[model samples]
Target: MAFGKSKNRRRQDAAQTKEAVKGAVRSHGPGLLKAILLTGLTCAVVWGGIELRRWALSSPTFLLKETTFSGLQRAAPGELLKLSGLTVGQNLWALDVEMLERTMAAHPWVRTVEVRRHFPSSVSVEVSEHVPAALAVLGDLYLVDEDGEPFKRLQPGDTLDLPLVTGMDREDYLADEAKTRERFRQALEVARAYAATEPTKRERLSEVRMAPEGLVLVLADGTEARLGEGDTDAKLQRLSRVREELRARGLSAGVIHLENRARPGWVAVKLSSPASERSGASQ
Candidate 1:
Protein backbone atom coordinates (compact mmCIF):
# COMPACT_ATOMS: atom_id res chain seq x y z
CA MET A 1 0.00 0.00 0.00
CA ALA A 2 2.92 2.48 0.77
CA PHE A 3 4.60 1.84 -2.57
CA GLY A 4 1.35 2.42 -4.54
CA LYS A 5 0.79 5.75 -2.72
CA SER A 6 4.38 6.94 -3.49
CA LYS A 7 3.95 6.10 -7.18
CA ASN A 8 0.61 7.99 -7.32
CA ARG A 9 2.24 11.14 -5.76
CA ARG A 10 5.07 11.08 -8.34
CA ARG A 11 2.57 10.85 -11.24
CA GLN A 12 0.62 13.87 -9.89
CA ASP A 13 3.84 15.97 -9.64
CA ALA A 14 4.80 15.16 -13.23
CA ALA A 15 1.32 16.24 -14.46
CA GLN A 16 1.65 19.57 -12.58
CA THR A 17 5.08 20.21 -14.08
CA LYS A 18 3.81 19.64 -17.63
CA GLU A 19 0.89 22.08 -17.09
CA ALA A 20 3.26 24.80 -15.77
CA VAL A 21 5.50 24.46 -18.78
CA LYS A 22 2.52 24.83 -21.13
CA GLY A 23 1.37 27.98 -19.31
CA ALA A 24 4.85 29.50 -19.51
CA VAL A 25 5.04 28.82 -23.23
CA ARG A 26 1.64 30.39 -23.74
CA SER A 27 2.86 33.54 -21.93
CA HIS A 28 6.20 34.06 -23.73
CA GLY A 29 5.77 32.46 -27.19
CA PRO A 30 4.35 35.61 -28.87
CA GLY A 31 7.18 37.76 -27.42
CA LEU A 32 9.84 35.42 -28.80
CA LEU A 33 8.21 35.47 -32.24
CA LYS A 34 8.11 39.30 -32.23
CA ALA A 35 11.79 39.47 -31.30
CA ILE A 36 12.79 37.18 -34.18
CA LEU A 37 10.72 39.25 -36.66
CA LEU A 38 12.32 42.53 -35.50
CA THR A 39 15.81 41.05 -35.90
CA GLY A 40 15.02 39.90 -39.44
CA LEU A 41 13.65 43.36 -40.40
CA THR A 42 16.80 45.12 -39.10
CA CYS A 43 19.02 42.80 -41.05
CA ALA A 44 17.02 43.34 -44.22
CA VAL A 45 17.28 47.14 -43.84
CA VAL A 46 21.07 46.98 -43.40
CA TRP A 47 21.46 44.75 -46.44
CA GLY A 48 19.30 47.10 -48.51
CA GLY A 49 21.38 50.10 -47.52
CA ILE A 50 24.63 48.36 -48.39
CA GLU A 51 23.28 47.25 -51.79
CA LEU A 52 22.04 50.77 -52.53
CA ARG A 53 25.45 52.22 -51.80
CA ARG A 54 27.14 49.66 -54.02
CA TRP A 55 24.74 50.43 -56.88
CA ALA A 56 25.26 54.17 -56.54
CA LEU A 57 29.02 53.76 -56.59
CA SER A 58 28.96 51.69 -59.78
CA SER A 59 26.21 53.59 -61.57
CA PRO A 60 26.97 55.42 -64.82
CA THR A 61 24.35 58.08 -63.97
CA PHE A 62 26.75 59.61 -61.46
CA LEU A 63 29.55 60.04 -64.01
CA LEU A 64 31.06 63.49 -64.17
CA LYS A 65 29.92 65.42 -67.24
CA GLU A 66 30.94 69.00 -66.64
CA THR A 67 33.22 70.95 -64.32
CA THR A 68 32.98 74.67 -63.62
CA PHE A 69 35.20 77.16 -61.82
CA SER A 70 34.65 80.60 -60.34
CA GLY A 71 36.66 83.37 -58.60
CA LEU A 72 39.60 82.50 -60.85
CA GLN A 73 41.99 85.36 -61.62
CA ARG A 74 45.50 83.99 -62.00
CA ALA A 75 44.96 80.22 -62.00
CA ALA A 76 44.05 78.85 -65.38
CA PRO A 77 40.84 76.80 -65.41
CA GLY A 78 42.31 74.04 -67.52
CA GLU A 79 45.42 73.82 -65.38
CA LEU A 80 43.34 73.64 -62.22
CA LEU A 81 41.22 70.86 -63.69
CA LYS A 82 44.33 68.99 -64.68
CA LEU A 83 45.84 69.45 -61.27
CA SER A 84 42.72 68.08 -59.62
CA GLY A 85 42.95 64.95 -61.79
CA LEU A 86 39.22 65.12 -62.34
CA THR A 87 38.36 64.17 -65.88
CA VAL A 88 35.02 64.02 -67.59
CA GLY A 89 33.38 60.58 -67.51
CA GLN A 90 35.08 59.80 -64.21
CA ASN A 91 32.89 58.65 -61.35
CA LEU A 92 31.87 61.72 -59.37
CA TRP A 93 31.29 59.78 -56.16
CA ALA A 94 34.69 58.17 -56.46
CA LEU A 95 36.56 61.50 -56.48
CA ASP A 96 37.96 62.50 -53.10
CA VAL A 97 37.05 66.15 -52.59
CA GLU A 98 39.65 66.90 -49.91
CA MET A 99 42.46 65.38 -51.96
CA LEU A 100 41.39 67.36 -55.04
CA GLU A 101 41.32 70.60 -53.06
CA ARG A 102 44.81 69.95 -51.70
CA THR A 103 46.10 69.27 -55.18
CA MET A 104 44.64 72.49 -56.59
CA ALA A 105 45.91 74.48 -53.65
CA ALA A 106 49.44 73.50 -54.65
CA HIS A 107 49.13 76.17 -57.36
CA PRO A 108 51.02 79.27 -56.26
CA TRP A 109 48.17 81.71 -56.88
CA VAL A 110 45.40 79.75 -55.13
CA ARG A 111 44.94 81.17 -51.65
CA THR A 112 41.71 79.29 -50.90
CA VAL A 113 39.71 76.63 -52.71
CA GLU A 114 36.30 75.03 -52.34
CA VAL A 115 35.22 71.99 -54.34
CA ARG A 116 31.61 70.84 -54.55
CA ARG A 117 29.72 68.10 -56.38
CA HIS A 118 26.43 68.98 -58.02
CA PHE A 119 24.31 65.85 -57.92
CA PRO A 120 23.90 63.52 -60.90
CA SER A 121 26.51 64.91 -63.32
CA SER A 122 28.49 68.03 -62.48
CA VAL A 123 31.25 69.36 -60.21
CA SER A 124 32.28 72.95 -59.42
CA VAL A 125 35.37 74.48 -57.89
CA GLU A 126 35.60 77.97 -56.44
CA VAL A 127 38.99 79.52 -55.81
CA SER A 128 40.31 82.68 -54.21
CA GLU A 129 43.58 83.85 -55.73
CA HIS A 130 46.10 86.05 -53.99
CA VAL A 131 46.14 89.72 -54.92
CA PRO A 132 49.59 91.21 -55.43
CA ALA A 133 50.07 94.21 -53.13
CA ALA A 134 53.78 94.92 -53.18
CA LEU A 135 57.13 93.48 -54.24
CA ALA A 136 59.41 92.15 -51.46
CA VAL A 137 63.13 91.96 -52.09
CA LEU A 138 64.18 88.78 -50.26
CA GLY A 139 67.31 87.77 -52.23
CA ASP A 140 65.05 87.01 -55.16
CA LEU A 141 62.13 89.40 -55.68
CA TYR A 142 58.70 88.04 -54.73
CA LEU A 143 55.15 89.29 -55.09
CA VAL A 144 53.70 90.09 -51.69
CA ASP A 145 49.97 89.89 -51.20
CA GLU A 146 47.80 92.34 -49.28
CA ASP A 147 48.11 90.19 -46.16
CA GLY A 148 51.93 90.57 -46.44
CA GLU A 149 52.53 86.95 -47.56
CA PRO A 150 55.04 86.52 -50.29
CA PHE A 151 52.99 84.16 -52.48
CA LYS A 152 54.78 84.04 -55.79
CA ARG A 153 58.28 84.56 -57.08
CA LEU A 154 58.55 87.46 -59.50
CA GLN A 155 58.83 85.77 -62.88
CA PRO A 156 59.46 87.44 -66.22
CA GLY A 157 56.47 89.17 -67.89
CA ASP A 158 54.77 89.76 -64.53
CA THR A 159 55.04 93.52 -64.52
CA LEU A 160 53.08 94.92 -61.57
CA ASP A 161 53.82 98.53 -60.68
CA LEU A 162 53.62 98.27 -56.92
CA PRO A 163 55.60 99.61 -53.95
CA LEU A 164 58.90 97.88 -53.20
CA VAL A 165 59.67 96.63 -49.66
CA THR A 166 63.35 96.42 -48.74
CA GLY A 167 65.62 95.48 -45.75
CA MET A 168 64.17 92.03 -45.13
CA ASP A 169 66.98 89.48 -45.21
CA ARG A 170 66.36 86.14 -46.90
CA GLU A 171 68.39 84.35 -44.24
CA ASP A 172 66.21 85.80 -41.51
CA TYR A 173 63.11 84.65 -43.38
CA LEU A 174 64.54 81.15 -43.74
CA ALA A 175 65.35 81.02 -40.03
CA ASP A 176 62.04 82.38 -38.72
CA GLU A 177 59.14 82.67 -41.16
CA ALA A 178 56.70 84.18 -38.65
CA LYS A 179 59.05 87.00 -37.67
CA THR A 180 59.72 87.87 -41.28
CA ARG A 181 56.00 87.96 -42.05
CA GLU A 182 55.39 90.27 -39.10
CA ARG A 183 58.11 92.63 -40.29
CA PHE A 184 56.65 92.58 -43.78
CA ARG A 185 53.21 93.37 -42.33
CA GLN A 186 54.59 96.37 -40.47
CA ALA A 187 56.25 97.70 -43.63
CA LEU A 188 53.03 97.20 -45.58
CA GLU A 189 51.12 99.14 -42.93
CA VAL A 190 53.44 102.10 -43.32
CA ALA A 191 53.15 101.94 -47.10
CA ARG A 192 49.35 101.82 -46.93
CA ALA A 193 49.28 104.72 -44.49
CA TYR A 194 51.41 106.85 -46.77
CA ALA A 195 49.24 105.96 -49.76
CA ALA A 196 46.07 106.95 -47.91
CA THR A 197 47.57 110.24 -46.78
CA GLU A 198 49.20 111.19 -50.08
CA PRO A 199 46.82 109.87 -52.73
CA THR A 200 47.80 112.55 -55.21
CA LYS A 201 51.44 111.52 -54.94
CA ARG A 202 50.75 107.82 -54.44
CA GLU A 203 52.55 106.85 -57.62
CA ARG A 204 55.56 108.84 -56.52
CA LEU A 205 55.93 106.55 -53.49
CA SER A 206 58.59 104.03 -54.47
CA GLU A 207 60.25 102.11 -51.63
CA VAL A 208 59.43 101.32 -47.99
CA ARG A 209 62.71 100.63 -46.20
CA MET A 210 62.50 98.79 -42.88
CA ALA A 211 65.28 100.60 -41.07
CA PRO A 212 66.57 99.62 -37.61
CA GLU A 213 65.56 103.03 -36.27
CA GLY A 214 62.08 102.77 -37.84
CA LEU A 215 60.55 103.02 -41.31
CA VAL A 216 61.68 105.23 -44.16
CA LEU A 217 59.57 106.16 -47.18
CA VAL A 218 61.44 106.96 -50.38
CA LEU A 219 59.70 108.71 -53.21
CA ALA A 220 60.46 108.49 -56.90
CA ASP A 221 62.17 111.88 -56.71
CA GLY A 222 64.78 110.66 -54.16
CA THR A 223 63.07 112.33 -51.15
CA GLU A 224 63.21 110.45 -47.85
CA ALA A 225 60.72 110.70 -44.98
CA ARG A 226 61.75 109.04 -41.72
CA LEU A 227 58.87 107.79 -39.55
CA GLY A 228 59.69 106.38 -36.14
CA GLU A 229 57.59 103.74 -34.43
CA GLY A 230 54.09 104.58 -33.06
CA ASP A 231 51.65 107.39 -33.93
CA THR A 232 51.88 106.59 -37.65
CA ASP A 233 48.79 108.47 -38.71
CA ALA A 234 49.61 111.62 -36.74
CA LYS A 235 53.16 111.67 -38.02
CA LEU A 236 51.92 111.20 -41.60
CA GLN A 237 49.53 114.13 -41.15
CA ARG A 238 52.38 116.35 -39.95
CA LEU A 239 54.48 115.26 -42.91
CA SER A 240 51.62 116.09 -45.30
CA ARG A 241 51.35 119.60 -43.89
CA VAL A 242 55.11 120.10 -44.16
CA ARG A 243 55.07 118.85 -47.77
CA GLU A 244 52.34 121.36 -48.71
CA GLU A 245 54.26 124.16 -47.06
CA LEU A 246 57.48 123.24 -48.85
CA ARG A 247 55.69 123.07 -52.20
CA ALA A 248 54.25 126.54 -51.63
CA ARG A 249 57.70 127.87 -50.79
CA GLY A 250 59.16 126.40 -53.99
CA LEU A 251 61.50 124.21 -52.00
CA SER A 252 62.36 120.49 -52.04
CA ALA A 253 63.42 118.40 -49.08
CA GLY A 254 66.06 115.72 -49.22
CA VAL A 255 65.16 114.34 -45.82
CA ILE A 256 62.06 115.12 -43.75
CA HIS A 257 62.69 113.86 -40.21
CA LEU A 258 59.41 113.42 -38.35
CA GLU A 259 60.95 110.88 -35.97
CA ASN A 260 62.61 113.29 -33.57
CA ARG A 261 62.34 111.56 -30.17
CA ALA A 262 63.83 114.62 -28.42
CA ARG A 263 60.94 116.93 -29.43
CA PRO A 264 57.55 115.41 -30.21
CA GLY A 265 55.15 117.14 -32.65
CA TRP A 266 58.06 118.85 -34.39
CA VAL A 267 59.49 118.10 -37.87
CA ALA A 268 63.07 118.71 -38.98
CA VAL A 269 63.64 119.27 -42.66
CA LYS A 270 66.91 119.21 -44.63
CA LEU A 271 66.60 121.16 -47.84
CA SER A 272 67.79 119.63 -51.12
CA SER A 273 70.77 121.97 -51.33
CA PRO A 274 73.96 120.89 -53.13
CA ALA A 275 75.93 123.99 -51.91
CA SER A 276 74.92 124.33 -48.26
CA GLU A 277 73.10 122.21 -45.65
CA ARG A 278 70.17 123.91 -43.94
CA SER A 279 68.18 122.31 -41.09
CA GLY A 280 65.09 123.78 -39.44
CA ALA A 281 62.39 122.45 -37.07
CA SER A 282 58.73 123.31 -37.45
CA GLN A 283 56.01 122.83 -34.89
Candidate 2:
Protein backbone atom coordinates (compact mmCIF):
# COMPACT_ATOMS: atom_id res chain seq x y z
CA MET A 1 0.00 0.00 0.00
CA ALA A 2 2.78 2.45 0.92
CA PHE A 3 4.58 1.70 -2.35
CA GLY A 4 1.38 2.40 -4.41
CA LYS A 5 0.86 5.67 -2.52
CA SER A 6 4.47 6.78 -3.26
CA LYS A 7 3.99 6.00 -6.98
CA ASN A 8 0.80 8.15 -7.07
CA ARG A 9 2.73 10.97 -5.39
CA ARG A 10 5.51 10.78 -7.96
CA ARG A 11 3.02 10.92 -10.90
CA GLN A 12 1.33 14.05 -9.39
CA ASP A 13 4.76 15.66 -8.87
CA ALA A 14 5.63 15.08 -12.55
CA ALA A 15 2.32 16.61 -13.74
CA GLN A 16 2.89 19.65 -11.51
CA THR A 17 6.41 20.19 -12.91
CA LYS A 18 5.06 20.10 -16.52
CA GLU A 19 2.36 22.71 -15.65
CA ALA A 20 4.97 24.91 -13.95
CA VAL A 21 7.19 24.97 -17.05
CA LYS A 22 4.21 25.90 -19.32
CA GLY A 23 3.16 28.70 -16.90
CA ALA A 24 6.70 30.10 -16.80
CA VAL A 25 6.85 30.27 -20.59
CA ARG A 26 3.36 31.83 -20.80
CA SER A 27 4.25 34.45 -18.15
CA HIS A 28 7.51 35.56 -19.92
CA GLY A 29 5.95 35.65 -23.43
CA PRO A 30 4.52 39.23 -23.01
CA GLY A 31 7.81 40.51 -21.56
CA LEU A 32 9.78 39.01 -24.45
CA LEU A 33 7.38 40.63 -26.96
CA LYS A 34 7.73 44.00 -25.18
CA ALA A 35 11.55 43.75 -25.31
CA ILE A 36 11.43 43.11 -29.04
CA LEU A 37 9.06 46.06 -29.57
CA LEU A 38 11.35 48.37 -27.57
CA THR A 39 14.39 47.30 -29.56
CA GLY A 40 12.60 47.90 -32.90
CA LEU A 41 11.42 51.33 -31.77
CA THR A 42 14.94 52.30 -30.73
CA CYS A 43 16.33 51.24 -34.12
CA ALA A 44 13.60 53.16 -35.95
CA VAL A 45 14.34 56.34 -34.00
CA VAL A 46 18.07 56.05 -34.68
CA TRP A 47 17.48 55.46 -38.39
CA GLY A 48 15.05 58.39 -38.55
CA GLY A 49 17.56 60.67 -36.83
CA ILE A 50 20.30 59.66 -39.22
CA GLU A 51 18.10 60.31 -42.22
CA LEU A 52 17.12 63.73 -40.88
CA ARG A 53 20.75 64.62 -40.31
CA ARG A 54 21.67 63.60 -43.85
CA TRP A 55 18.82 65.64 -45.28
CA ALA A 56 19.89 68.68 -43.27
CA LEU A 57 23.51 68.41 -44.37
CA SER A 58 22.75 67.94 -48.07
CA SER A 59 22.15 70.95 -50.34
CA PRO A 60 18.53 71.68 -51.32
CA THR A 61 19.48 72.09 -54.95
CA PHE A 62 22.14 70.26 -56.93
CA LEU A 63 24.05 73.36 -58.01
CA LEU A 64 26.17 73.26 -61.11
CA LYS A 65 29.76 73.02 -59.88
CA GLU A 66 31.28 72.64 -63.35
CA THR A 67 30.21 72.68 -66.99
CA THR A 68 32.01 71.06 -69.92
CA PHE A 69 31.47 71.14 -73.68
CA SER A 70 33.25 68.94 -76.19
CA GLY A 71 33.37 68.48 -79.97
CA LEU A 72 31.85 71.88 -80.42
CA GLN A 73 34.00 73.93 -82.75
CA ARG A 74 31.51 76.36 -84.27
CA ALA A 75 29.01 76.49 -81.40
CA ALA A 76 29.83 78.75 -78.49
CA PRO A 77 29.83 77.08 -75.08
CA GLY A 78 28.00 79.88 -73.33
CA GLU A 79 25.32 80.01 -76.00
CA LEU A 80 24.82 76.25 -75.95
CA LEU A 81 24.65 76.21 -72.16
CA LYS A 82 21.99 78.88 -72.22
CA LEU A 83 20.00 76.90 -74.77
CA SER A 84 20.38 73.70 -72.73
CA GLY A 85 18.33 75.10 -69.84
CA LEU A 86 20.93 73.87 -67.40
CA THR A 87 22.48 76.35 -65.01
CA VAL A 88 24.16 76.59 -61.61
CA GLY A 89 21.97 76.14 -58.52
CA GLN A 90 19.46 73.97 -60.35
CA ASN A 91 18.15 70.69 -59.01
CA LEU A 92 20.07 67.78 -60.57
CA TRP A 93 17.15 65.40 -60.85
CA ALA A 94 14.81 68.08 -62.17
CA LEU A 95 16.67 68.58 -65.46
CA ASP A 96 15.51 66.61 -68.49
CA VAL A 97 18.75 65.69 -70.25
CA GLU A 98 17.11 64.00 -73.20
CA MET A 99 14.78 66.91 -73.85
CA LEU A 100 17.65 69.36 -73.62
CA GLU A 101 19.70 67.37 -76.13
CA ARG A 102 16.73 67.17 -78.50
CA THR A 103 16.20 70.92 -78.27
CA MET A 104 19.84 71.60 -79.12
CA ALA A 105 19.67 69.21 -82.05
CA ALA A 106 16.91 71.33 -83.56
CA HIS A 107 19.54 73.92 -84.39
CA PRO A 108 20.60 73.45 -87.99
CA TRP A 109 24.30 73.42 -87.25
CA VAL A 110 24.10 70.71 -84.61
CA ARG A 111 24.31 67.22 -86.07
CA THR A 112 24.29 65.26 -82.82
CA VAL A 113 23.97 66.24 -79.16
CA GLU A 114 24.37 64.39 -75.87
CA VAL A 115 23.73 65.82 -72.41
CA ARG A 116 24.82 64.03 -69.25
CA ARG A 117 24.97 64.90 -65.59
CA HIS A 118 28.08 64.49 -63.49
CA PHE A 119 26.35 63.65 -60.22
CA PRO A 120 25.81 66.21 -57.44
CA SER A 121 26.56 69.38 -59.43
CA SER A 122 27.88 69.24 -62.99
CA VAL A 123 26.36 68.78 -66.45
CA SER A 124 28.47 67.97 -69.51
CA VAL A 125 27.36 68.53 -73.09
CA GLU A 126 28.87 66.92 -76.14
CA VAL A 127 27.82 67.90 -79.64
CA SER A 128 28.86 66.77 -83.07
CA GLU A 129 28.39 69.86 -85.19
CA HIS A 130 27.18 69.41 -88.73
CA VAL A 131 29.90 69.52 -91.37
CA PRO A 132 27.86 70.85 -94.25
CA ALA A 133 28.35 68.89 -97.43
CA ALA A 134 26.60 71.54 -99.45
CA LEU A 135 24.12 74.37 -99.11
CA ALA A 136 20.79 73.44 -100.71
CA VAL A 137 19.47 76.68 -102.19
CA LEU A 138 15.91 75.68 -101.46
CA GLY A 139 13.34 78.14 -100.12
CA ASP A 140 15.17 77.78 -96.84
CA LEU A 141 18.98 77.85 -96.87
CA TYR A 142 19.10 74.19 -95.89
CA LEU A 143 22.46 72.78 -94.91
CA VAL A 144 22.99 69.30 -96.35
CA ASP A 145 25.34 66.86 -94.66
CA GLU A 146 27.79 64.54 -96.48
CA ASP A 147 25.06 61.90 -96.68
CA GLY A 148 22.89 64.54 -98.36
CA GLU A 149 20.58 64.66 -95.36
CA PRO A 150 19.22 68.20 -95.09
CA PHE A 151 19.47 68.68 -91.37
CA LYS A 152 19.12 72.39 -90.93
CA ARG A 153 18.91 75.64 -92.86
CA LEU A 154 19.72 79.22 -91.99
CA GLN A 155 21.08 82.46 -93.40
CA PRO A 156 24.53 81.99 -94.90
CA GLY A 157 27.53 83.31 -92.99
CA ASP A 158 31.14 82.58 -91.98
CA THR A 159 30.35 79.28 -90.28
CA LEU A 160 30.04 77.26 -93.50
CA ASP A 161 32.36 76.88 -96.50
CA LEU A 162 30.72 73.94 -98.32
CA PRO A 163 29.59 73.92 -101.94
CA LEU A 164 26.26 75.44 -102.93
CA VAL A 165 23.59 73.14 -104.38
CA THR A 166 21.16 75.18 -106.47
CA GLY A 167 18.47 73.38 -108.39
CA MET A 168 14.75 72.54 -108.08
CA ASP A 169 14.37 74.57 -104.94
CA ARG A 170 11.32 73.78 -102.84
CA GLU A 171 9.87 74.47 -99.43
CA ASP A 172 8.68 70.89 -98.76
CA TYR A 173 12.02 69.15 -99.12
CA LEU A 174 12.19 68.21 -95.49
CA ALA A 175 8.57 67.04 -95.35
CA ASP A 176 8.70 65.06 -98.59
CA GLU A 177 11.10 62.46 -97.35
CA ALA A 178 10.69 59.88 -100.12
CA LYS A 179 11.60 62.18 -103.02
CA THR A 180 14.24 64.05 -101.07
CA ARG A 181 15.86 60.83 -99.90
CA GLU A 182 16.25 59.60 -103.47
CA ARG A 183 17.76 62.87 -104.65
CA PHE A 184 20.00 63.08 -101.61
CA ARG A 185 21.30 59.54 -102.11
CA GLN A 186 22.21 60.27 -105.71
CA ALA A 187 24.02 63.46 -104.82
CA LEU A 188 25.89 61.76 -101.98
CA GLU A 189 27.10 59.00 -104.26
CA VAL A 190 28.27 61.45 -106.90
CA ALA A 191 30.05 63.64 -104.35
CA ARG A 192 31.83 60.63 -102.81
CA ALA A 193 32.91 59.33 -106.21
CA TYR A 194 34.18 62.76 -107.26
CA ALA A 195 36.08 63.12 -104.03
CA ALA A 196 37.87 59.83 -104.73
CA THR A 197 39.33 61.18 -107.99
CA GLU A 198 42.56 63.19 -108.32
CA PRO A 199 42.69 66.62 -106.73
CA THR A 200 42.46 68.40 -110.08
CA LYS A 201 39.44 66.37 -111.13
CA ARG A 202 37.84 66.85 -107.72
CA GLU A 203 38.28 70.60 -107.97
CA ARG A 204 36.84 70.67 -111.47
CA LEU A 205 33.74 68.65 -110.49
CA SER A 206 30.85 71.02 -109.85
CA GLU A 207 27.31 69.70 -109.32
CA VAL A 208 25.42 66.41 -109.60
CA ARG A 209 21.94 66.41 -111.09
CA MET A 210 19.54 63.59 -110.20
CA ALA A 211 17.83 63.24 -113.54
CA PRO A 212 14.97 60.83 -114.29
CA GLU A 213 17.16 58.74 -116.58
CA GLY A 214 20.13 58.78 -114.21
CA LEU A 215 22.68 61.16 -112.66
CA VAL A 216 24.54 63.86 -114.59
CA LEU A 217 27.81 65.29 -113.25
CA VAL A 218 28.57 68.81 -114.43
CA LEU A 219 32.19 69.89 -114.21
CA ALA A 220 33.43 73.40 -113.46
CA ASP A 221 34.46 73.76 -117.08
CA GLY A 222 30.94 73.14 -118.51
CA THR A 223 31.58 69.52 -119.48
CA GLU A 224 29.09 66.87 -118.30
CA ALA A 225 29.12 63.07 -117.82
CA ARG A 226 25.89 61.12 -118.07
CA LEU A 227 25.61 57.97 -115.94
CA GLY A 228 22.54 55.84 -116.57
CA GLU A 229 20.24 54.82 -113.72
CA GLY A 230 21.94 52.47 -111.23
CA ASP A 231 25.40 50.85 -111.50
CA THR A 232 27.28 54.08 -110.69
CA ASP A 233 30.32 52.07 -109.56
CA ALA A 234 30.97 50.60 -113.01
CA LYS A 235 30.52 53.98 -114.73
CA LEU A 236 32.96 55.73 -112.36
CA GLN A 237 35.49 52.95 -112.97
CA ARG A 238 35.24 53.43 -116.72
CA LEU A 239 35.65 57.20 -116.39
CA SER A 240 38.83 56.70 -114.35
CA ARG A 241 40.35 54.30 -116.92
CA VAL A 242 39.49 56.57 -119.85
CA ARG A 243 40.83 59.65 -118.08
CA GLU A 244 44.15 57.87 -117.32
CA GLU A 245 44.50 56.80 -120.98
CA LEU A 246 43.81 60.34 -122.20
CA ARG A 247 46.39 61.77 -119.82
CA ALA A 248 49.01 59.18 -120.83
CA ARG A 249 48.47 59.53 -124.64
CA GLY A 250 48.44 63.35 -124.74
CA LEU A 251 44.75 63.86 -125.58
CA SER A 252 42.01 66.39 -124.60
CA ALA A 253 38.33 65.53 -124.85
CA GLY A 254 35.00 67.11 -123.93
CA VAL A 255 31.87 65.40 -122.59
CA ILE A 256 33.36 62.04 -121.72
CA HIS A 257 30.23 59.89 -121.93
CA LEU A 258 30.09 56.61 -119.97
CA GLU A 259 26.33 56.34 -120.56
CA ASN A 260 26.96 53.66 -123.20
CA ARG A 261 29.64 51.23 -122.04
CA ALA A 262 29.77 49.34 -125.38
CA ARG A 263 30.98 52.46 -127.18
CA PRO A 264 32.28 55.35 -125.03
CA GLY A 265 31.84 58.73 -126.79
CA TRP A 266 33.77 62.02 -126.48
CA VAL A 267 33.81 65.42 -128.17
CA ALA A 268 37.04 66.21 -130.15
CA VAL A 269 39.89 67.86 -128.23
CA LYS A 270 39.37 71.63 -128.59
CA LEU A 271 42.38 73.38 -127.02
CA SER A 272 46.17 73.20 -127.63
CA SER A 273 47.43 69.60 -127.03
CA PRO A 274 49.31 69.98 -123.76
CA ALA A 275 48.58 73.51 -122.58
CA SER A 276 47.58 73.67 -118.92
CA GLU A 277 44.19 75.30 -119.57
CA ARG A 278 42.56 72.94 -122.07
CA SER A 279 39.03 74.06 -122.93
CA GLY A 280 36.52 71.71 -124.57
CA ALA A 281 34.25 72.74 -127.47
CA SER A 282 30.45 72.62 -127.04
CA GLN A 283 28.79 69.56 -128.58
Off by over 4 Å in 2: 1-61, 159-161, 164-168, 171-175, 201-203, 241-254, 261-283
Q: What is the C-alpha RMSD of each candidate to the true structure, in Å?
A: 2.4, 7.9
Q: Look at candidate 1 and tell me the lDDT of residue 28.
A: 93
Give the true-structure RMSD of model 2: 7.9
lDDT of each: 0.89, 0.69
Which digits, one per residue and each the tens of the lDDT, describe model 2 over residues 92-145?
666788888987777656889988888777888889987777767678667787
lDDT of 1 by residue, 1-283 (tens): 9999999999999999999999988999899999999999999999999998898889999999999999998789899988888899988888899999999999989999999999899999999999998999999999998888899999997878888999887898899988888988888888888888888754368999988998899987788999978789999998889888888988888998989887768898888986645555665
- Evaluate model 1: give its TM-score: 0.89
Q: Candidate 1 — what's its lDDT? A: 0.89
The list of candidate 1 runs beyond 4 A from truth reads: 1-31, 201-203
Top model number, TM-score:
1
